[model samples]
Target: MTTHLITGAGSGIGAVLAQRLLERGDDLVLLARSASRAAELAASYDGARTVVADLADPASVEGLDLPASLDSVVHAAGVVELGAVADLGVASWLEQLTVNLVAPAALTRVALPALRAARGTVVLVNSGAGLTAHPQWSAYAASKHGLKALADSLRTEEAEHGVRVSTVYPGRTATAMQEKVHAQEGKDYDAADWIDPGTVAATILHLLDVPRDATVPDITVRPNA
Candidate 1:
């Protein structure tokens, strides 16, 4: 059975993805900021193990102890700070980047040994914002753009080492993050326009379901109007 490590497994798409993976009979490792939430999720997923760590904190990431070998890593942890470029605070900007970009890359680097050993896939949950800029979304766009670059670089660097990287550009997923963005907008964004989190998880599973001789570098899953 494949062992999958998923970050941000406490809520939103991350939680949904974890559920699908668990049902598929994969051993799971859930990493999240809140231990209680992670524990609850773990309990729901056949008592899977939980690791508590803040991805934004470098020391916390560096201190993680995972299995000696991992079949895959679904990097579902991310953050969003909405504001015009001028109004976005430097500190908040860094925090967003830390969680959305730096932490993923750093975590991937740390998990390299185990991933390479298992020829594992790294699933990066990027966003449409990374591909197209929008007003009041400067920080999110920048972080996702950086994350896309990281995925590309890792794919090239790790292929020879037998590890594959997959970057997912999903548009307006019906997640808590999306709700937060909509709530702050003073209007209800069309939930009908949102992509199903389960569908996204299935797409990710497709990326890993490929033959060992094949590789899928990138994919865009958007809700069609």
Candidate 2:
């Protein structure tokens, strides 16, 4: 059976991806910010399993109980609080940096041995903001940019071990996070205006389902409007 460990399985693309995998009878280990949150996800995903950790606190990653060998690690948990460089407080900057970038790197480090043993994949769910920065997206973009760098370096370092690293950059997706972004921008959100999270989830699954002989280093998904 295929096994995938995923963060942010509670919602958005991760949630859709988890549901698809579960329906196909794949094994899953999901991350939850707290024990209560873990319970919620357990019930939501039909009691698959979960590990408790706050992505905003990178130190919490050191305690994650990951499987000995697994097929994949999907870093989909992220937070964004849009503010210009001039006004974004240090707390906001730190939280985004820790959750969106630092925590993934730390978690991947601990999962390396298991990944190598299985010659698995590590997929990082990034954003279009990772590629282009607008006026109020400084902190979030910087963290995602750093995440891209992390993946590039890891891809090379782990190549000999046969573990593939891929980063998927999705354009504005209709998720609670996008709604928050619209609220910050003082604009109304219309889910129909954005790409469906399930579409992006399908893209991630394609990368995972491909034949073992080849690997995709990066992919970008954008709305067709």
Tens digits of per-residue lDDT for model 2, 119-210: 99999999998888889999999999999999999999999999999999999999999999999999999999999999999999999987
Using TM-score, give the best candidate's number.
2
The regions of model 2 sitting more than 4 angstroms off are none
Model 1 score (lDDT): 0.86
Candidate 1 backbone collisions, by pair = none
- Global fold similarity of model 2 (TM-score): 0.98
Q: Give the per-residue lDDT digits (tens) of candidate 1, residues 191-211.
A: 677898888888888997889
Give the Cα RMSD of candidate 1. Answer: 1.3
- For candidate 2, give the lDDT: 0.93
Error of 2 at 195 (Å): 0.3
For each candidate in turn, the TM-score is: 0.95, 0.98
Q: Global lDDT of each model?
A: 0.86, 0.93
